[model samples]
Target: MSPAFRWFHQDVSSRYTGLLCLFAGLLLPFAFAPVGIGLLAVPLLAWLFFAWSDASPRQAFRYGFLFGLGQFTAGVYWIYHSLYEFGHIPTPVSMLLVVVLAAGLALYPAAAGYLANRISLSAPSMRLLAIYPASWLLMEWLRGFVLTGFPWLNLGASQTDTLLAGWMPVVGEYGVTLLLGVSAGALVSLFRFRSGYRWPVAVTLLSALWISGWVLQQQNWTETSASLSVSLVQGNTPQELKWDPDARTKILNSYLILSEEVWKRDLVIWPETAIPAFAQDIEKFTQGLSGLTKLTGSDLITGIPMVEKGRYYNAIITLGSESGRYYKRHLVPFGEYIPLGSAFGSLLDLLHVPMSDFSTGRLDQPPLKVAGQLAGLSICYEIAFSSVIRAQLPQAGFLVNLSNNAWFGDSIAPHQILQLSRVRAMETGRAVLSSTNDGITAVVDHRGQIQAQAPQFIGTVLNAEVLVQTGATPFVRWGEWPVIIFAILLLVAGFVRSCYQENQPEEKTRG
Candidate 1:
């Protein structure tokens, strides 16, 4: 029997494989923040390749689904917190929604496993190095775009603190995912390579990826244009009172009072829906804000719902110096705009969500002019999409992300979004001013480092001098196409090779 054949193609499946996958899935969250052992993503993913090495297509599917179940189960538990604690959804329904969302996402991993086995690759290196990662990346890419996408918890986001982040400017997050997948495949090769230079090759692959990332990190993709002094307001408005009529004037007064002393800064940011009412409803107040910002030479950008011809929008408006307005283009399903509302009419009536029907702004909305600079704007959930940030780039000197994560309330979701906004900063080669209601108001520099941040659940202002940058990273110029296309080509090569092996019945007696 050939050593390569025996190493990869085997009947050595174990009884504990299911639990192994389940626990390995559990390891997925630990690889990301709150417990940010970033490199753990390697060993965490290695378990999947290791388990699928000797399983049938059906077994591989089951194992993959279990791995995904474990992953989202741990990763997205905050959905329940957002729905029940803040949305005031019933406990039973909230729990069911969480389970359903996780199960739906699990299908991607399950498909990855089924395809890996269905495509025959007897040669150990080819199977582990090519077919495996490519299959995984393609499935994940699909998961990111389908149904307006939930690109959260993508493996690439977990690599922000790693050397792999150096590659982010050039290839974006999914590219990092592809590279990370290769790293996981190499890890499995280390254990199964048996004898010869395959072990050294696997080591070399990992080292090259790490070294390249570090080397890339040292290169300056964007040049500093100027330093802009900024202040972020953490209103600490409880989600329960955020939309309350009695609390409306008090909330507005609290934010205005907090900014009283800090308006001299170049830019002042407020969290999503900080106004807590329609712009027309508070026209007199907005006019006064415009006058105040102009008097202080500060550009104030805040989230205030705008009503235009009777359509509602979750929008960001700039006042003073040069003004610009951007309505959120990517709306969160059910939260921002319900999907198939009529189909789930009964359920919707029960949930009674607010700001749930926001109309999306134009896709080509230009960046807002603020503080003598142009900045990209993303409202709450919109920051998760790279397109929302990139569309404003080459024109935008910095990025502004406004969110109301009080709904998440002390969950890792707030931290997770903070992490993601930083990734956008890295990808676009632009500074990011991400302000959230209550906590995690932070300023991230062009290199994706946090310059300053406010403490969670505080009604205080976080002030910092942020660098405004010029020029675009490769990611801004070219989106995820390079990585997506590369994955597609790799899968094609694997399929063709698998087909050749099938037609060659007389070729080998390996194993």
Candidate 2:
């Protein structure tokens, strides 16, 4: 075997091997936003594929789970900060929650590793190139969908700032995952066959993909129609003070006072729950504000909780141009609405968050018309769902993402979310207006590049012009169907080949 492939012979059950896998996973998050070194994912995943080589299903599961546990434990440790510092959970219980969540997420990778090895072909080329990538993406797809999903820390997220990001408008994030997996598999093949004829071929193919991405990045999938001047208000209200009765008026006044200067602009936006009061409770105030904006021909959009028919909803309302509203559909688990609320009702009492039972919005709500452009609204966590973003389509000229990230403090969660919002802009070929309470309030162009931004932990307003994009990218049209179908086919083919190989050896032994 080539020296490059020698690692494949290492004992999977060895203590040192497990440690190395854990370390690899720990290093994975640095590849994502706020520390954007995307190339690290290639070698890390290659190492994982090598460790899985020649391992039993059980051994593969253990190695994969360890990697996942380490990955989540490091990547999303911010959850502990939110739960304890913000949710008011005890320190020990918060730590325990993090551990349990990490362990649960680890099972996806464990299942993927088990299935990969169980159905792997004997040929090194086929096993690493086809089977491994397919299995990995299948797990990623499943992870994104199962139990309302928590698609954080996806491998493709690391590629957001790299050349691979260009593939987003064409195939969306999952398609980018498939491309990334193929690159990792190629890296493994290149190393495993260093002395064979295929190593050079792998090198050529890898270079082609990277170069193709760069070329794709140069093309414009969506056309810029008109530009609308906008102002995004960042209240920067502390989470502790947000729900306090005395602070409610202060928060509303702060946003209004900030907008007083920029109300002449085509559109003005506020962060999620900027009002900190129910829509009906503030009806007279909203109506007066709406009249003022109408007189000035300015459209004002702000986040506020709404109580109608005795059901509360987390929603955004537009008060000018063409009046409309968008209620958030994909509510945050526990934060917005508790999942399995009946069973977890007692547990939710321990959480300090307010209005934790907001009802989901209708799936078919139309985009709000702001300054003659259709604006798709995503309140906080809803931006993480690509399908929900894509559903707006070519009709919604640009996207407006309103969020209150103060709950996560200064952790990487907010930065990671900003990164995801950028990807969403790229995927749909629309400029994104990402307005937040505490930071990262920015204007992203159609290409997913940040044009302007506000600093975190400050009360400020971001002023910029976003282009109305008209054409649709391939991703906006097809969504994840193509890549998903391709992954399923690859998995089936890999297992069929493995079955044939298993039978051939038995026939020869019988002869």
Q: What lDDT score goes with residue 510 in model 2?
A: 94
Model 2 alpha-carbon miss at residue 155, Å: 1.2
Residue ranges of candidate 1 with Cα displaced over 4 Å: 1-12, 506-511
Each candidate structure's TM-score, on Cα atoms with residue i matched to residue i, is 0.96, 0.97
RMSD (CA, Å), each prediction: 2.7, 1.5
Of the candidates shown, which would achieve the greatest lDDT relative to the real structure? 1
Residue 14, model 2: lDDT of: 48
Global Cα lDDT for candidate 2: 0.86
Number of clashing pairs per prediction, in order: 0, 0
In candidate 2, what are the lDDT values of residues 1-511, reduced to their tens digit?
6763565465443446667888898888898878878889888887787777767889889888988998899888988988998778899999999989988998888888899999857677777777887888889889887988888888877887889987888888888888888888888787778677778878887898889999999999999899999999999999999989998888888888888899889999999989888988878899998998989989999998998788899989998877778889888888888889889877567887788998999988888888988999899888888988988887999999999898888899888888888889889999999999998789998899999999999999999988999989999999989988998899898888888988997999999
Badly placed stretches (over 4 Å) of model 2 are 7-15, 507-511
